[model samples]
Target: MAEEKQTCYEGSSVQSFQFYLEHSGEHKAILQCVHNLLPGEFKRVAEGKSSLDVLGVGSGGGEVDAQMLTLLQSTVPAVPITADIVEGSSALTDNFKALVAKTTNLQKIPFAWHIMHSEDYEKHVKAKGVKKFDFIHMIQMIYYVDDLAESIKFHHSLLKKNGRLMIIIETAHGGWDTLWKTYKKDLCVHAITEYRSSAEVISCLKSQGLKYEEHVITNAFDISECFNPSSQTGQRLLNFMTAKDNFYQSFTSETRAGILDLLKNKCSTQRDGGVFFNSNLSCILVHA
Candidate 1:
């Protein structure tokens, strides 16, 4: 185990993230958001516009972005879409580019992909005096941001009138939140990334007096393997969960044991012969 601590973003951790995506209920939650609110919201935003501008923060592999654009197309046919995708990972960018290449549906959407994190994107926008966007979204990516209020305020400012800022994050008081709250000092990842949830976002919006709509998505993930000390996949998943690079082997036995106990008893529950995490999410739509 290494002496130094690291955030989940450290190293080439995309493989573990992909694995987590596949194993978790995150996709289902996204689909729920799309079906329940996004289509109508897209239609509302596009009703009077000849062209739509969208900014996607941390658009990973373009899957959700593609779905959203497809919804936009369905809602308002032949409406021109200009999309700007900002992501930190080149591999995800490559995957997004490949996904776009193979998918015929998004051919009409003119896309500009920027290989940078959200903070850098903000800098670039400030330097370039970027135009306001009709829509902006960040899905499960808020955790990595340096300043929650600044990021929220900046993104909210970028929206055109009657526009929307979409943010999806883990719900506060969920198992993950409890775990982070209990062990953040030892973990040390919170300092780097804020390690927050929907509650913080909502609080920020409320404090900012930003008008918004909230959508709650309840889902769970299989965490049964987390108990297996020898399972490499389990260790990686734990690392991803805690935003720690080497969570299982890097910590003291007491800390690790306590964390495991919290994971089993506090953060998760058992069902269907598997340990399911309380991995709920809240999707907030800040109105501008």
Candidate 2:
């Protein structure tokens, strides 16, 4: 019998993630990386073209989408842009809609929301005869997909000739990987997989028979600002690190205490006050 497929985002993880996003300063970091990845000029380039259709795959909370919308509105005012947000979580979709309502720039653009899994969205696009999008983006969410190559192909199919498919991934290179490797035994359980390198992303895109351009954009966060035990940010981080009950149980009280202490000390120190983490965003600007 075939093994059942594992769901990427669980309820507990989603709740924890929402909390973490609010406090961890990752939102800012992500926004910065994305800004550097796709400068305002790209929007102008797309606008100079004939047709404009943009799709954001796995658009969680619509934070990045909101930014993209703002860029498009400013750079390509003449182009009537249609953005389709493909997200599976209803809660996330709801939050995205609320954000859209609040943001003036995002509200001005014509947009659609599809509450469907990435795979299902691909199928729907194929069946509905929607073949090409001017631009397609997957930001920090591709790691969750079961089959990376297949997923890339699906998104590639949605691109028009010479259209660009951009992917922004958080590089698992610096302190982020160091911390995870050090605490993996005590902090990680369930043997989840993470794509940790740019080469892997490049290889996957190549296997899909797509040619692309790549750029590495790096940004850092000061963990000191959010690592206090008594602070809301610190608590959120704790909760995020301990999402699964069984996973939490794997660590001895002493080990848990030690990790917390380490985090606290690291956050408090002036020399390393900034929990410096960098993301090398491998953007594959593909042509169809």
Candidate 3:
């Protein structure tokens, strides 16, 4: 067996992680996209069945988890829920706890917060000590895993029969796809790894003997203000573009100029007051 990799969140100070969460509205939007794609009947079945147990892998700050819990409560009031958050970051876990404490609806659901890496969660289940969950969610965090197949298999093992593992990823064919594919040389140092697409995920799941339902949700981000040097978003973008060593080293002078030019053009258009960057989010609902 291969050694498990430590999670990104491990050993990070809670304050630093909290700062990331505070600026993570974009991530929250992504979670909302996943929540919208979840099967309605599953919510009903979860409510009608025994207590619904949910596990959120890479659940950062619990903002997304809180939103999903609200949706569950409103849609399936009878399903008693116990949400176990498996987070790698202690700082992020603290932020998640604070968010839970502040949110009334989240308090209604039986919530257990676990500060551990995904591999640890898998090991716990393999020991046959943990209860099977009705739903398992991993949103936007799959890219960090060293072994995607093993991660999926672990999640599959955690589910009760007929339970669903819903994963959302950035598609390889979206507008963001173009940006990452082309600029990763310059961007990889600062930005995260390219995510697996919906098709790739489906194929992988099928290879593991898991049946799944998949869908893509497209959304756009307006970042016109981010391009303007005077605007805060623009300044942020500028700093992000210039601060990373990989970005500066990866692109030729001309290519770097072109990328910045594209950013400027996209950011300045007044018709929408921002550049509309479209993203295709792939949601895979797996039956384990």
Candidate 4:
């Protein structure tokens, strides 16, 4: 809104995301879900294959992608694996490349990194038109796509027989979701923004008569700093949460107070001397 002096996808947005991740701490439960689910899916996809083709969309910094790929390699150790990762931020792409350079464990897995958004990656692959993958994952990435339905279909089409497409997204009932939904019209004015949850994805799959399984990853984080109106760290967390500039100052005093009250009473809980919000996330396994 207000022409967005700085949007969430360019410039320093990479630092914004890093700050959010650092403040949110480790999402162990989400990682655990991936660890538990990917092995079985890898076995299913690699059943009759000697090699694996995987795609990662919006694979920021390649942290989760590395984890999932490592698990897949362990599950089907004999199968050679190739991965094509798409990311929009060059800063993040550089970080991923640096991580890849130092991580000896991932050396055996050949990676093709495309430092671009999901829509461009779609256009890139359409030129070849003959490529398909045993596994395709869009981790915390569905929000940044230009066309939600077409993007989902495009990825689904890339799945080989019995292959799995995994999507990780925020749950509809989290503090982030609560904030986004309330301010959705403003935040989603950007071409790269759309706030959708696993439920929406599941509904889309069901509407298309596709098969899918859903797993909810329940987690929480201490957001006590957000209550402090003067804390810069708090501001960074709030900026990432809202993906908006001048969040508190932009709102009317009455509106900001209401928002703070709603955040505490409806979206989070008080525990262990910290204000924690249920940053619940979910993963949907769409099968081909």
TM-score, predicted candidate 1 vs. hidden true structure: 0.93
Candidate 2: stretches off by over 4 Å: 1-12, 36-48, 178-196, 224-232, 241-282
Q: Against the true structure, whose TM-score is highest?
A: 1
lDDT of 1 by residue, 232-277 (tens): 8788889877666788667899998999899989999888888889
Question: Best candidate, lDDT-wise?
Answer: 1
What are the lDDT figures for the candidates, one per model? 0.83, 0.65, 0.67, 0.79
lDDT of 4 by residue, 121-239 (tens): 78878986746898998878787766688888989999988889998888877776787777676556664367887767877888888888888888888888888999887777777
- Model 4's alpha-carbon lDDT is 0.79
Ordered by TM-score, highest first, the candidates read 1, 4, 3, 2
Compare candidates 3 and 4 on TM-score and give the better one. Answer: 4
The collision pairs in model 3 are: 9-89, 14-91, 186-247, 224-274, 226-233, 226-234
Task: Give candidate 1 regions above 4 Å deviation.
Answer: 1-11, 190-192
TM-score of each: 0.93, 0.76, 0.77, 0.92
Q: List the residue pairs that clash in candidate 1.
A: none
Cα error, residue 122 of model 4, in Å, equals 1.4
